[model samples]
Target: MSKQTDAAKEGVQQLDAAAAKVRLAELAKALGAANAAYYQDDAPDLSDAEYDALKRENAALEARFPDLKRPDSPTEQVGAAPSAGFSKITHSQRMLSLSNAFDASDVQDFVGGIRRYLGLGDNAPLPFTAEPKIDGLSLSLRYENGTLVHAATRGDGTTGENVTSNARTISDIPTTLSGAPEILEVRGEVYMSHADFAALNARQEDAGDKTFANPRNAAAGSLRQLDPAITKSRPLRFFAYAWGEVSVPLAETQTDALARLEALGFQINDRTKTCDSGEEMLAHYARIEEERADLGYDIDGVVYKVDDLSYQRRLGMRSTTPRWAIAHKFPAELAWTSLEGIDIQVGRTGALSPVARLKPVTVGGVVVSNATLHNEDYIAGRDANGAPIRNGKDIRIGDTVQIYRAGDVIPKVADVDLSKRPATAEPYAFPTACPQCESQAIREEGDAVRRCTGGLICPAQAVEKLKHFVSRAAFDIEGLGAKQVEAFHTDGWIKEPADIFTLRERFGQGLQQLKNREGWGEKSAENLFQAIEEKREIALARLIFALGIRHVGEVAAADLARHYTSWDALAETVDKAAPAATAHRAAEEAIVAERAKAADEGRRANLSAARDAAWADTQPEAKAAWDDLIGIDGIGATVAVSLVTTFQQATERASIDRLVAMLTPTAPETRATDSPVAGMTVVFTGSLEKMTRAEAKARAESLGAKVSGSVSAKTDLLVAGPGAGSKATKAAELGIETIDEDGWLALVGDG
Candidate 1:
């Protein structure tokens, strides 16, 4: 009977091992597919929770049957294959993956294993670094002599795709580092935070383009774009996590290495902490997990790395994961919930977005009652039969939709189950007029957005705009909020940007009255006034953006400021701009006629004759003035016409004059001629030798000479750096002189 029991036990063990092998194979394949979708294609097939679950299952099976683990298992890889579109690059040192622990017990067990391996005493504590595992694409950035040379996305640990151009577009990823190592290869994650991703997706939907699923997908897509221009448009950011290959050693500990990275112009995740023991690490993981939703970015787990580099070296690594580091993933936060109704929200730009009001459900440890439907098109399952669909078919009042809370904060409608939709459900009809202002809503050609023509008159738009004006990225006026903006706008205390400056006078009469109201006091009023005073002398770029000009953003504002120098100069430029010849005659007849005669036989003959007669022979004084105006960079035919047309309006001109009178503007600093290729017309094409194309362009711009996107006849000296392809040929055709890196350096007196 005992021998029979032993045989049964052996059979059970064999069955379990066989099942574990099959599970490991399945997990490996699933993980590989998910990785391909996430990294190579910039499209994820599985939810964050589902992906983590699969990964966890794979890890468990691998632990049970360590001998059956495959070399190409997802557990053994750093990242997926290199994206085909980007140039392939091999890393100097292979990027290793981390082992994982899910809970406090798991963490304690891991620490125990480490102590046993090190032969330390039973109660001995290990110092470690606990940091949020940013859910973004892993990348390696190489620097030579304090300047960024190249950037690559992690692909299968040993090899990666070169994303130098896209990486350069990230504002936080510095082109040149300060106090940097002689040669450094810093590893980090490129990501778009939740807020930025939402905003980006919103813009993309409004522009009638495909929207990203989440921040991770958006960051991956943006980073892998072939054209740097596309990447520049996305709000992608980077956070340094670890080192790849370095000429000079960093610090003795992981925490010190982080400090060094921060000092060298790399942005490190702010949620990193040092722990004296595994218990402290577990505590930190709990605290961060609790505060996860409040954070603007997505973090799937917490990473605990051995602080001491020497200790880490001693621990070494397994064939796959590092022995000194482990990832403590938070539990999955997704759950099924019923969709109750759909509501539409009007944004500051008058974009009407559909939102799903769901039966409250807990996902990722947070209660979610609402999910963003994105737009009308998203509501409907099909595209326009023939015509371009504006908004997706409006989501009906009642429909069963799959809801997901990414990072336990942003609730988004993932899918709709038409089978469960009510039989009585009717197609939702989008409003043709502004709900708040009764203004006509117009969907412009080639635009998906339907905006109200009421402008600042709409209460919803006005309040939102006012809030944006005082937002941290804008004027940053203290003591002002969405509620306060609405209150002030409702009371007629402020009407436009200029009204913000006049708030003291307009609200002075009601100042004492406001102080008497709830949540208002003398000190509060004084603080508000002081805050407003502080913003009176804002930078030219901020002032331009705060005005909320159509189609103008931070980058555009910066460009305008750099070109015009001050508020007055920019006002003069924009106002003096005439209308383009192609503009509607009724809208710009006078301005267009003033600039150029109509295309008629007699007019063409007269213009030709005037040109042949030379500047001295015909309108010499006017010619000199026109030449002076046209010579300015960024001032072209379209811009010049727009400026002239604006200035022609008496009301617009008066407003500009008033704004200029009330404000003081500062001049931008001139470039220094110390760097190589300074003051040279550098046209970067194909590839680069020393830096990313963006870094080279930025360097050239800072030094002086104009940086034109296309090679032109007027190009004085084209610095034909490495990767000089079509532009180099164009320069030769135009008889534009060209130089290599050494020649460019000599010209700039930096050789």
Candidate 2:
């Protein structure tokens, strides 16, 4: 080696852990801020080469001081914070970021890393698939029993924005898939074609409207539109190359899995190929890079993944990236911009999300104007974990912000030019009240969000909830949409959910019928009524979810419905759980009163006594119900609280009762015939290392078992993971059989 190169290596080797740690900390902070600017704000502060060099430095430092590596290291992250425009979706399994390979040596190192991690020799040839990495938004499309239910974006790995409505508008995405698993999450890239992008921009320019910079940005902006019709009007495509949660394995190898996705009517990239060695993978990458422009869509680089699924499982994952895969990303471009203003938007859950509005600046071809501010803490210059960011520098209006866009990625704030900061700038104040309804907003303990407590009266929450109720996964009544629901609510024809079912009866007299209303015809009015009547018989799971319980999503509702089987059973159980809910609220009041009068220990003792007294007042039936609801595998005290509190409220109950009176809730379906675990009420707690919690529940249900979220008197078994909590103690108290992951897997017979 050259003297200079040898000296650099020797210098790195001479550094002790303590000194290395200092450098590592600096590298981590710098790298993190740079990434946030690139990924979150689409405003890159550093050039591509500079960013890569910083990452390399961080990786080398971590190698020197392995123990000093923080869990939030930028090397492990994939995407930026999800934009708050739509409802947020949490993935069952984490969507990991990929390790990057910059050049041929990097690609060689990637293969070598996998081999070394798996204890394979240099001579051993492991097959890998090299596919063109489409530079577009990543999406996860979930299906249940061969039917496409929803689609979500890859927002910060664990959670993303729900784009199910706009996704449904894409002709390339299948609404139904026959011969698919009972549960499947097919992951892929969603992008627009070159020709389509040009046409869209042309139309925009002609209409004197905002035009997109590239196909990727066009695809992202269009797909995220609140109006599905707009997305449908634009031409977009998808290429399924991977997956997340699944009921059954798709294929033994990556190539076969891609074939399976294609057979299921998904579009897979045609240029994808399997390579047996590093050299072959590099050759494929070269070919793709050479032909990228002619592919009709944008592809930034080549992605190489281990062909064997078994090897992938064995290799597993690090903090952010999987050991079995790497993405050879193209270089990034950067630009400068000015921070104009910040705005707050309230979601259905009453979360006040802050958005950064920027002065239009061209970055990587896209005209970027706004980016995700994430939360109040972010604006105040703090990380999610409360760490000071950019030396604790707060983002303010009138500051010159750096920005960048790569492929279809959103433009993000890369960094701030402190020299350009204005003296008149003031710290952005996060609102303490809902922006829409002016209700007092509150951020719960251990939560970053400040939620508005005006559930019944808040216009934003009420409207979003109503829209979700008529959404495809819920009631899915024909002719009812977001606009229609808003209109009905405004016209006093529909107020609460129950009013949707009563529309015809209230407004259908000869002269007063909906047919006589403006924009209404006799045939259309009759069709809507028939549609409403047809939906009178709904599934229990759908009904439960349509209620818009805070913690009860489609999966949770399914878990509850399957455990109870019948609507009346669930209602009665929730009603019985009400006493516990009342006890909880009473305990809260007692704790506050006791704390004011006593020391810590005395307060604790008094609180325990008050809770015991409240429980003693609860009827035996109510106590049993509370225990049972809490006994479900996923149901916790918080979820139980939401359910019981909603059920016990007079107004809530009146609306629910009216809806139930008007419709019949059919029993949730289960596949229990001739299965050993069929009819078994099971609760899974803690973490299951073998499969995701969702996957475990799905497997158990496929064998005819009823998986409940919590532990209760009716629970037959508890599948406890490591560090099992109160549920484990309760299971012992209830004398319910408890098993570990291995025991549970053995009982279900992993297939």
Cα lDDT tens digits for candidate 2, 1-751? 2232232233334344433443443454456556555544544565444554455445444545555554335554556566656788999888886655545666788898788666678999799999998877789999999998889988778988789999998888999999999999999988988998899999999999988756766777787787789889989889898999999999999999999999999999888999999999988887887787799988767899999999998777765778899877554455677898988876656777676788887654445677545567666766556777556777898988765432212334445788999999888888999888899999775566678888768877777678768855579787776678888777767778888888777774422467667888888788888888999999998898888776676657776887787888888888877877787667777777676667755533466776676567878877788777876665677778989878877877898899899889988676856777888888889977777665576678778987776777778889999989998998999899999999988887663
Q: Write down the TM-score for model 1.
A: 0.50
Per-residue CA lDDT of model 1 for 1-751, tens digit only, reads: 1232222222112223323333343345456667767777777776555566555545444544555564435566567767777888999988777776644656787887777666667767678899999988888999999888999888877789999988999998999987888999999888888889889989999999998766877888888888899999999999998997788789999999999999887898888999989879988987898899999998888999888898787677665588888888664334556778777656666666556788888654345677655444445533323222212333566776655432212345544566677888888776778778889887654344467777656876766667657754468677675568778788777666567777677666446966876799988887887788777777877766665444344445555666566676565444333322122233344444433654543443353344333322334333333332343343344434444554565754565466556665555555775655444444545544544454455556767655655565445667776667887898788898887867755665555
- Candidate-wise lDDT, in order: 0.66, 0.74
lDDT, model 1, position 12: 18
Q: CA shift at 418, candidate 1, in angstroms?
A: 2.1
Which one is best on TM-score?
2
Deviation from native of the Cα of residue 292 in model 1, angstroms: 14
TM-score of each: 0.50, 0.59
